[model samples]
Target: MGVDRSMWKMNPERLQEHLQLKNRARQIPDKKKESKKRACRVSRRALPLFPSLSV
Candidate 1:
């Protein structure tokens, strides 16, 4: 089987740009995780404010 030459048309610089964008997308959840940790830490003090609903 012959290799496809069409896939190699991308410029090296463009490939690097795409890779950097993908890496930044991967790091987004990490920031959210840190915020969630802070929220959980503060939530304990606020939990009692919401009264439990009886069915």
Candidate 2:
């Protein structure tokens, strides 16, 4: 089904901008996953020091 013209006011630039924002939204989760992996790596490396520091 085709979208209604009134929805975007026939503005092609608005449609392109909306598409670009959608693409950026899709990339955000991948960046979050990468940062999470880095955090997990840091925590694993620090795990050994915890027990010694606690005693």
Candidate 3:
């Protein structure tokens, strides 16, 4: 039987480019990481303004 080249939905070169783009995106830090650092900082700033709540 002949190989079914149409079985591949994407062209091989385009598929490789798409995968590389995905890997590049994975290296960037997203908003969740930034917001987590900001959240931890909130208590430090809040504690100064609300001294009674800090107890």
Candidate 4:
């Protein structure tokens, strides 16, 4: 279960794009975590001002 390197060499630009995509994919989890943290902070701040809306 390995990629064929020869096929990658046929188009360096495509390979570079693929590598960049892979790198971005790896950063997705961290990005999601940061987004969730920001969302939590926002929700917490809003909650205090909207206590009457809560059941």
On TM-score, the candidate that comes out on top is 3
1-55, model 2: which lDDT tens digit per residue?
6765564674788878887886898777787789999999998998886687888
- The superposed Cα distance between candidate 2 and the true structure at residue 27, in angstroms, equals 0.5
TM-scores for all candidates?
0.38, 0.37, 0.48, 0.39
Every candidate's lDDT: 0.76, 0.79, 0.81, 0.80
The order of the candidates by lDDT, greatest first, is 3, 4, 2, 1
| 1 against 2, candidate with superior lDDT | 2
Q: In candidate 4, where is summed lDDT lowest over 10 consecutive residues?
A: 1-10
Better-scoring candidate (lDDT), 2 or 4: 4
Please give the RMSD of candidate 4 to the true structure.
7.5
Prediction-by-prediction clash tally: 0, 0, 0, 0
Off by over 4 Å in 2: 1-10, 30-55
lDDT of 3 at 22: 71
Per-residue error at 49 for model 3, in Å? 19
Candidate 3 structure quality by residue, lDDT tens digits, 1-55: 6864654788889878877887899898899999999998996787687679878
The regions of model 4 sitting more than 4 angstroms off are 1-10, 30-55
Alpha-carbon RMSD, candidate 1: 8.3
Between which residue pairs do clashes occur in model 4? Answer: none
Sorted by TM-score (best first), the order is 3, 4, 1, 2
Q: Which candidate leads in lDDT?
A: 3
